[model samples]
Structure formats: structure tokens, C-alpha cells
Target: MTSGKPISSHLLPLDPRRRRSLAWAAGLALLFPLAW
Candidate 1:
């Protein structure tokens, strides 16, 4: 979609549970690369 949605909207999803899970996943991803 060519809609000009703000990037922050995607970063912070509407679902609280999903947002928390995404934060956890993002943290794990960052840590995984460092632990490699």
C-alpha cells in the first residue's frame, strides 16, 4: 500500500500483548547477534 502511514505506527502496534511480544523478540534478536 502506498499510503503514507507514519513509521511509528508500525513500530507500536495497537495490541498490547503483541507489542510486548514484539519487544521481547526484538530484544532476543539483538542479544542473539551479540552472543554469536
Candidate 2:
């Protein structure tokens, strides 16, 4: 079996999509506070 370090390193390639979704979710959360 592979080591845990290699498994965590593989997740590094997901940065772009993850960052974009995170920004979008943050924006929606901010809008919610204004709407209330």
C-alpha cells in the first residue's frame, strides 16, 4: 500500500476548482447576511 504522505500530496492538484467553489460559497454567505 502507498504511504499517507503520497495520498495527501495528491490532493494538492485540486486547488483551482476547490478555490473557486470556496469563493462562490463565501460570496453567497455574505449576501445572506445582507438579505436578512
Candidate 3:
């Protein structure tokens, strides 16, 4: 296995929950553009 792939995969998971968190962040950024 590639060492880089193992390390990067740990950092960013392949799951639906991750997308939900990303969307939550975008919503927060839109609501508080200056704070983000």
C-alpha cells in the first residue's frame, strides 16, 4: 500500500456524515461571513 494514501485517507474519511458537516460549515459561513 502507498504510505501517502494511508495517511491522507485517515485525514479525510469517505462517509456521508462528512458531507453533512461540510454543508453545515457552508451554512455557518453564509450566516456569519465575517466570523468565518
Candidate 4:
């Protein structure tokens, strides 16, 4: 499994802005389903 995808690539940047945006998107997505 050593040849598999490297998770470090995704977590390398550690950008707070992108993370906050992603968190907002995720929160909205989760709340959207409840609206119906």
C-alpha cells in the first residue's frame, strides 16, 4: 500500500483561508439537507 495516494499532499499547505471556506461550504451543505 506504499504506492497509494499520499495524504500529505492535501495537508501540506495548511492554509487557514481555504480551510475556513471549506468549513463554511461544508456547514452549508449539511444545513441545506435539513431545509427540506
Give the CA lDDT, 0 to 100, for residue 6 in model 4. Answer: 53
Pairs of colliding residues, candidate 1: none
Candidate 1 lDDT for residue 33: 92
lDDT score for candidate 1 against the true structure: 0.72
List the candidate 1 regions with Cα displacement exceeding 4 Å: 1-8, 11-13
TM-score of each model, in listed order = 0.60, 0.53, 0.48, 0.59
lDDT of each: 0.72, 0.73, 0.68, 0.67
Model 2's alpha-carbon lDDT is 0.73
Report the Cα lDDT for residue 18, model 3. Answer: 78
Model 4, span 1-36: residue lDDT tens: 642235335645778787678668878988999996
Candidate 1 C-alpha lDDT tens digits along 1-36? 643255337856567887778678878988999999
lDDT of 2 at 1: 72
Model 3 earns a TM-score of 0.48
In the range 1-36, model 2's lDDT, one tens digit per residue, is 765467446656778788567658868988999999
Clashing pairs counted in every model: 0, 0, 0, 0
The CA-based lDDT of model 3 is what? 0.68
* Highest-scoring model, lDDT: 2
